[model samples]
Target: MILKPVPISAEQFTPFGDLIETGSDPIAINYGYTERHHDLASLDLLEQEGRPIVSIFRSTPLPQPVTLNVMERHPLSSQAFIPMGNQPYLVAVAPAGEFDASKIRLFIVKPGQGVNYHRGTWHHFCLALNAVSDFLVIDRSGKGDNCDEVTLVEPITVDLSDCEESTAR
Candidate 1:
């Protein structure tokens, strides 16, 4: 039960891949007043390894777009995303140790950035608009199924919520 929340930046994402691009687009405010453009980019990371092991891919992502209901938790794994095309939307779930209304955050994987999830870390699925979101994922892979879901007692609004309490940490 630990709530150590930190940003998965270039230094942290390096072990997973290389940062070579950055791009962005604008996201409008609700009142139809203020508008802000976001940056996105493409990135490449070479993860060297021994003999034949995990499969290498151009952009293999989760088949199903995780339609998150509020936020959820995974008791046994951490998930990571590396934005390859457009900017990525990062929502997340958390263990009680890391759960705090003032702490949970979202990360924008601007085109050139990517990430590697530590084991048993709670997270949200990928969020991207316009073009396809791509990434090189590194995680435990096996024939056996590996997924567990836990609904939160209270749901959190992803698109519409208080500005301060929600965002990538």
Candidate 2:
């Protein structure tokens, strides 16, 4: 099956998770030097001795016509990925619960946007586009195996033909 990605938005992505982006009504803080987009995502940790851990994931661009054969989920806590640079990326996800390949959805995340997958939401890893990128990853760190992976019976091909030519490569 071929999957096409659409632009990421809070409304459309709410079922799977939160869309981390700066809203128009940001609060001015630090003597007006900083604008805080407060409470963008709800971190669902603290289950089964689960604690939040922050890390940086450096990712390289995927090969053209990206194909995904596996999906993973964090059953114990939510996972958030914030890009450290002004580059676009792709997000592939499915709703929490039974692993249904047909329920998968793709999104094109532009610069200045990030994503927070709700606990147990099935998703693919960071998909950097154009060049190497770094993402600030926030997720759970504790016992009882938070991650679960499932290999797809049929690989899904992500079609980038509709995306901007520059980033599609």
Candidate 3:
């Protein structure tokens, strides 16, 4: 199956997770030097002695016509990925429970946008485009089998020809 990615938005991505982006209404803090987009995502990490951990993920871009054979989910906690650079990326996700390959959705995440997958939402790993990128990953720690992976019956191919041209080179 071939998947075309659409631009990420909070409304379209609500079923799977939260779209982390700066909203128009941001509160000014630190003597107006910082504008805070508060409460963008709800971190669900309080189950089974789970604690939140922050880490930096340096991702290398995948080859053209990216194909995905497997998907995973964090059953114990939500996972959030915030890009550290202005590089764009792709996000593939399916709703929580019962892995269904046909239900998978693809999204093109532009610069200044991030994603927070709700607990149990099946998702592919970070897909950096154009070049190597870094993301601030926030997820659960100290869990009992938080990760669940399933091999797709059929691989999904993503067309990125348009994405390459649109994103920063």
Candidate 4:
């Protein structure tokens, strides 16, 4: 299977989770010295069985034409990634349920954009493009086995060169 990444936006990504983007709507706060895009995403971590953990992930960039061999999810908590700097990345997601390859959608995550995956949302791991990137990760720290993985029967190939071609034209 092959997938093409679509441009990401807040509205288009709502079904999976929140899209953290600060557009032109920030309000001044803290004695008007701060611009706050407050409460942009529902940072959901399962409270009944686990404590929330905050960590930083420094990921090396993946080259283009990547192969996606597996998908994973956390059943007990939602996961979020906030990039440390402006960088483009790739995000691929499928709805939570019986794993279906046809339902997967790919997005080109632009700079200044972040994602919060709803609990149990199946997703590919971080695919940083162009350069190494750092992200602030928030999720659960618990006793339960929350992580789940499914290997695809046939790995999906994702080529971003087509995207670049369209842009260049």
Candidate 5:
């Protein structure tokens, strides 16, 4: 299976989850001192939830045309990834329920865009395209089995050739 990533847009990504785009207009508050893009995503967490965990994930860049063998999902909580730098990255996802190889959708996110995967949304791990990138991740921290994984019977080749290429550092 070969997968080519598409540029991310809020509407196209709506089915899987929210695209917390920082590039959009913000709500000015506190006497115009603050710009807030409020309530962008619904953090649907498990009833027995632990405090949300905030951490930095620094992912090394991957070369273009990489092979993807696995996908995973967190059943207990939604996950958000906010890029700390203005570098493009890849996001691959599939809808919940029995995995369908044909249903997989790949997104190429530019800088200033963040993503929130609804609980149980099947997705690939972060695929940084440029220099080592850091992401601000917010999600459930404690208790219960939160993850499920599936190794593809046939690995998918992720090709970023059509998009603007980046030098990996």
Candidate 6:
């Protein structure tokens, strides 16, 4: 089944997990006096060609930029900043449906918070909204395709109704 992208805010995104907002660690916001605009397309790939029995779709989502203010870092993850790109990208997510509150938690990454994917942990694709996000990924990169997935029991509908309303304000 195809899953539409949903926007998870830090406030709401955390319950599903922990708020990895680092602010006290030096690697976080301690980078020496820095001044420069950086552009990055993390997973933005291009679809090559289609074969008789196969099709291709490159990373079409254009990379969006935002300032990532940091304070600390996750020592476990090797990846630095995993781009969530402009349009919210759908990675692997819990199947859409009711789940055990004990096993699954709902959390949102606020506009300023970006999460770095550990080498192989399961997660939803990047959800870039308006600004640059500093993410501290965690996992084992030694393994190829370090990505696995868990379809939620049902499906989730991202309610952009509020964002739509706020946009008009």
What's the TM for model 3?
0.96
Give, for candidate 1, the lowest lDDT window spanning 10 residues: 43-52
Which residue segments of model 6 deviate by more than 4 Å? 1-103, 116-122, 129-140, 164-169
TM-score of 2: 0.96
Query: Once superposed on the true structure, which residue ranges of model 1 sit more than 4 Å away at CA?
Result: 1-67, 70-79, 93-103, 143-145, 159-169
- TM-score of candidate 4 relative to the true fold: 0.92
Best by lDDT: 2
Error of 6 at 58 (Å): 9.7
Cα lDDT tens digits, model 5, 1-169, are 8888888899999988999876467889899998998888887765465668888999986665678888999988899999999788889999987888789999998888899998889999988886889999988877888899999999899877787654232
lDDT by residue (tens digit), candidate 2, 102-149: 999999998889999999999998899888999999998888889999
RMSD per model, one decimal: 12.4, 1.3, 1.1, 2.4, 2.1, 12.6
lDDT of each: 0.41, 0.92, 0.92, 0.85, 0.85, 0.32
Model 6: residue 79 alpha-carbon error in angstroms? 6.5
Predicted candidate 3 versus true structure: per-residue lDDT over 70-166, tens digit per residue = 9999999999999999888999999999988999999999889999999999999899988999999999899599999999888899977666565
Expressed as tens digits, the lDDT of each residue in 49-150 for candidate 1 is 211123333432323333344443333333445554554444343433454444445444544455544443455555543345555554443343334545
Cα error, residue 110 of model 6, in Å, equals 3.5
Error of 6 at 88 (Å): 8.3
TM-score of each: 0.45, 0.96, 0.96, 0.92, 0.91, 0.36
| Distance from true location, Cα of 87 in model 3, Å | 0.8
The 10-residue segment of model 5 with minimum total lDDT is 160-169
lDDT of 3 at 150: 96
Please give me the total number of clashing residue pairs in predicted model 1: 22
Kindly report the root-mean-square deviation of model 3 from the true structure over all alpha carbons: 1.1
